[model samples]
Target: MELPGGLGGNDAPDGESLPELLRSWRNRAYPREVSETAAPRRRRSGLTQRELARLAGVSERWYGNLERGEPAEYSEGFLDRLSSALGLGEAERSALYLRAIGRPPTSAVAPGSAAAAGMDLTLQQFLDNQAPNPAFVTDLAWNVIGWNDPLREWFPWAAQQGNQMLWALLAPQARKQLVDWEGSWARPYLGQIRYARAQHPDDEALASLEREILARSAEARKMWNLREVHEHADGDLRRLRLPCHRGREVSVRIVALRLMRSDRLRVNVLMESGRAVGA
Candidate 1:
């Protein structure tokens, strides 16, 4: 979707509005210090467009267009980098996104005045309540936010790996623990990310995760480049090699549920029978 980027003067967005806002933030990023008495004469230090573009990992021409409030595709990546370059806080980053993309970033959600707390308290309760079975919760980006003790006991890597997909695809422990690692774990987890990217094309964290996966694993890159989009772990049976059982494999079925409050947050339970499966 092409956003209206008419440099603010004509009427809809008030031409100079975005330009002035970006310029103000740029000045603040590199402000000239002044004494109490000298504060009266305090002024902005020079922060050229070229310098900002270099810092933001964008071309000078692209950033110049943004500074002038002209029409251009301002991606979430670009906006994130720009926010970082200008040293914007949560609130500032939210405001920048609102101005740039007509909506605040999915990651930088600030309700009213303060930044959002990463996870909901209720999610922990949900995880703990699901005892015996291995259960965990992940945010939209598939970052492992919360997990139950049973999960930590079964999938020990859950304690160290911050991201679920990253561990499934990149961690050496994953190959040792999951039988048929490629067909069972990697493909399904990547499928979830592929589906998410299709749904929210502007999610910066998701995009970054996909980029990292492609860069690190050739197998992942091949499957990803195949462009298959319908893989998901919910209801799929997977063979899990349990450490306590002398590396015996067990058939575990994945049950995924979206948290009632947020579709982005999911509760994943790995249900397994007491018996082990064949090799």
Candidate 2:
């Protein structure tokens, strides 16, 4: 099926589906870093989602639905509540706005979408245009070898975080910082990992990364054993609200980029709205 908003295209090899491409995309969309905030962040700051709703002046149901990534009506009121509750900054607020419409704030050029053998400057320009959005270039196994500065500026730990699927999950700080740690994240993350495993069973690097993450994190270990399969690209977008500079929340859209050059790897781009363009 053609993806919504021209997402997945119809150019895969015979018998290869968009879901397969999505799985490849998900592997590329690995988290930059585990949240490194203190445990107090999870304590809700002595406030509940309900309280945040009340403070933001929106209904609890509306707020809850947003967190779940459910399809629902969104209004300015709800955005205000989410902004206040999640501590979203101006840029993040705009990102949330774009996601509410089911589209990323920025556009990405897939690798190999062009005729060149190296990184495409046009593609790089597209990524560059997505200023204030934390986008990165990665391999099929989710190894982030390069990224724009906004990515590191927004999530400093990303640069230092081990570039692997499970390592980011195993980190305690990252675990605490995830907006929807279990449901929106852990489950599908492992699902994609398994999907990749099926494609590259003999890939020693992936095998070793899986072992390390499962060993270090009980949460990751439990999720990995489920043996579930999910294609990461199926137009699924995760609205992640992380604390950025000065504890301000920066909302971002984590999307996948399928490269044309190396089918073995892809770039995961993080984007936000409402910030000055270019980074």
TM-score (all chains, Cα) for each model:
0.57, 0.51
For model 2, how does the per-residue alpha-carbon lDDT over 43-152 read when each residue is reduced to its tens digit?
31234545444333344675556655566555432343344334444444444544455443221322111222244566567666666676766555565445567777
Prediction 2 global C-alpha lDDT: 0.51
Q: What's every prediction's RMSD, in angstroms?
A: 12.8, 21.6
lDDT of 1 by residue, 32-104 (tens): 2211122344445745676576555445787999888786557665576566557677666766776776776
Return the clash pairs for model 1, or none.
8-14, 8-15, 9-15
- Give lDDT: candidate 1, residue 66: 88
CA lDDT of each prediction against the hidden true structure? 0.66, 0.51
Best by lDDT: 1
Clashing pairs in 2: 34-174, 35-173, 35-174, 111-259, 111-260, 112-260, 112-261, 140-265
Q: Choose the strongest candidate by TM-score.
A: 1
| Residue 227 miss distance in model 1 (angstroms) | 1.3
